[model samples]
Target: MRFFGIFCIVAILCCDLAAAESPLVVIVHRSRHSPISVEEVARIFLKKQRYWKDGAPVVPINREARSASRRVFEQYFLVRVRSDLVAYWNEQYFHGVFPPATLESDEAVKRYVGADSNAIGYIAADLVDDSVRVVHRLD
Candidate 1:
């Protein structure tokens, strides 16, 4: 019984450690002209930010629509899914609201957002670097 209790406690602690170490990050180009909050970041990711300081389009890149990290990001950041978010965009798209471009891979997103001054993307926090500044980390 004592050994079983100790094993359970250790397992629980490991799980807690993993959960506490969040891996999702909100990344932007090396030149993020504007300081932003998590909410504004969500707005930009949803394609609401139509322009940047240079009057360029705010390009937002995304991971797979159903990725595990994306799901968490959507819930915590965007507060919705691609489908529901699309529905939201549809309402705004008619009003001339443009949406962000979607990318399929971490490397592609990193490369694209890193090279574009008006671009932003998300990736596992471990993948963040000087090329991509981390604006937020999901926990």
Candidate 2:
């Protein structure tokens, strides 16, 4: 019984560690019709740039707060939280500039951005599929 408990604990820990360390990836719309570089992706995440070359309005979508995925994204891609990022957005929003939109779920983000020409988002590296094109990989 003790051995079984120890094994379960070890297995749980391994699963958690694996989740915590999952690599994050950035992706753009499948119909975007442009090739993007890491620098360009970084710019979009930081809200420094807002449009693709084809004049499509670029919308950046983010995960919900408290999600493990959100932590990874902020630690690697975005540099701030919604309240703070909103402050940053507010500064630009009034100027006719906008920050990336926030989405609640991976599925919603995937569906909206994957089908739209003006949307982009980041998700787990392994979760990327043919419906989305990876633009950046976070270490």
Candidate 3:
């Protein structure tokens, strides 16, 4: 019985460690050549920065609020809780600015960013393919 309990604990720890190791990758269309900084990424997601340097409008895509990726992104990048973001968006809506459009899944976000040159989004690192370029990675 003691050995079985120890085995279960080890298995649980390994699963958690695996989850912690999977990174989130920030991605953009392959054609976007300008270097992206983390600060700029935060601004773009917050709807504070509206346009890219070439005059094209910045389109930021977000995963649904309930998604694990969204949680990780908010915790590490946005540094705000969902309720706080909701409040912020409510205020911004009054000013004619809107939050980034949210997709149902990482695949949807990847597809949208892959097709739109002005679009930027983040997804699990393992999901990244040749269709998009990775700008930054968050663990």
Candidate 4:
């Protein structure tokens, strides 16, 4: 019985360690050459930074609210809880600003970012390819 208990604990730890090691990557279309920062990513997602350095309008894509990736992204990148973001966006709505648009899946975000020079989005690091360049990565 003690061996079984120990095995279960080990399995749980391994699962958690795998999840923690899954890397999240921020990507932009390959054509975009400018560097980006976590602070800038936060600004773009919150609709504070409306344009890229080259004078192009910035388009930020977000994952669905309930996605695991979205939860991690919000915690590490935005540094705001869901309730606070709701209240923040409610205030921004009155001022003609809105939160970034959300895509249904990581693949959708990747495709959008890959096609648009002014677009930025985050996805699993393994999904990155030649069509997009990673601007930031969170491990």
Candidate number with greatest TM-score: 4
Candidate 2's displacement at residue 128, Å, is 1.8
Reference-based TM-score of each model: 0.71, 0.66, 0.81, 0.83
lDDT accuracy of residue 53 in candidate 3: 94
lDDT of 3 by residue, 41-97 (tens): 989999999999999999999887766677788788888887898999999999998
lDDT of 4: 0.86
Show model 2 residue runs off by greater than 4 Å.
1-20, 79-90, 93-98
Worst 10 residues of 3 by lDDT: 12-21
Tens digits of per-residue lDDT for model 2 on 1-139?
9999999879855654464576777777776656787667768877788777877667878766556666777766555666876687678878887545677556667777778768888776666787887777777
TM-score winner between candidates 2 and 4: 4
- The TM-score measured for candidate 2 stands at 0.66
User: What lDDT does the true structure give each of the candidates?
Assistant: 0.73, 0.71, 0.86, 0.86
Q: Report the Cα RMSD per candidate.
A: 8.3, 6.2, 6.4, 6.5
User: What ranges in model 4 sit over 4 Å off?
Assistant: 1-21
lDDT at position 93, candidate 3: 96
CA shift of 78, model 1, Å: 1.5
How far off is residue 42 in model 3, in Å?
0.7
**Which of the two, 1 or 3, has more TM-score?**
3
Residue 53 error, candidate 4, Å: 0.9
